[model samples]
Target: MDALLFMIFAAIAVICGINLVVQTHPISSALSLVGVMGALAALYLLLGGEFIAAAQLVVYAGAIMVLFVFVIMLLNAGTEKKLAIRPWGKYLGAPLLLLFFGMMAYVVQRILPESSPVVFGAFQGGTAAEIGRSLFTVYLLPFEVTSVLILIAILGAIVLARKEVD
Candidate 1:
């Protein structure tokens, strides 16, 4: 059951990732990215990384994607121009991509063939309390640095907007 669920979500993620790359319009690519993030969140849930899964949904899929869509809208981004592809590229690109994917799969299978299957209750320590404790304790410096980086980004955006107005 767990393997089946993992496979389903993994497939969804892969398809969405491809769609994100292949879509011509920015909005379509953004939507595809959201689908990929959501599928990844489900896969994280299957792996029992509950906190990480929730963060992925809330931060990446929700807030980040909303911000992306807002920027795309504000910038009035249009669909990408279609470029003429070489006949050789049209024939070879997909086959090369598939070959690369197959090689990666084979490498992963060889490396982790005996790995244990993920079960929901098999792992623990993903609770909010534990995560908070770890974040404040072991990961405090990195957390603080990230907060500062975000603050700087916000300030930079404000400055840029002000300059545009002036």
Candidate 2:
């Protein structure tokens, strides 16, 4: 079951990643990004990281995607086809991509821990009590900061969507 879920998410991640690179349409690219985020959330769920999975869904798929959609709508981004990359840009692109890959590889190698400790506990109830206890006990500062950041984001989005005063 785990293997199957892993394969499913792996495939989705790869496809969405490729779409992210190759799709020319901005809205389509954003949609593909949502797919990638959703697949990652599913992988988190399979790994027993339920809170992380929910956060991924709520933060990435819910708020971020809606923000992207709103921006696209506000800008009318998909109304016209974007111009193709120029030949000179294409000439410099391949090596840039290779350099980016190399840099990411180096960073991952440098940052990844040799061994990750396994966390054992159940905290999946969607009520305030379960979440509040976990947040206060384990992830107090980050949880509070994340809540504040989300509140700020909501305010910002509302401000952006408001009618302009003449």
Q: Which candidate gets the maximum lDDT versus the true structure?
A: 1
The regions of model 1 sitting more than 4 angstroms off are 85-107
Q: Which stretches of candidate 2 lie over 4 Å from their true place?
A: 1-4, 70-76, 84-88, 106-134, 163-166
- Residue-by-residue lDDT tens digits, candidate 2, 113-161: 5756323233245445666787898999898899999899989978876
Q: Global lDDT of each model?
A: 0.92, 0.82
Top model number, TM-score:
1
TM-score of 1: 0.83
For candidate 2, the per-residue lDDT at 2 reads 61
lDDT of 2: 0.82
lDDT, candidate 1, 1-166, per-residue tens: 8888888989999999989989999999999999999999988887678999999999999999999999999999998899999999999999999999999999999999898777876777886788999999999999999999999999998998778563
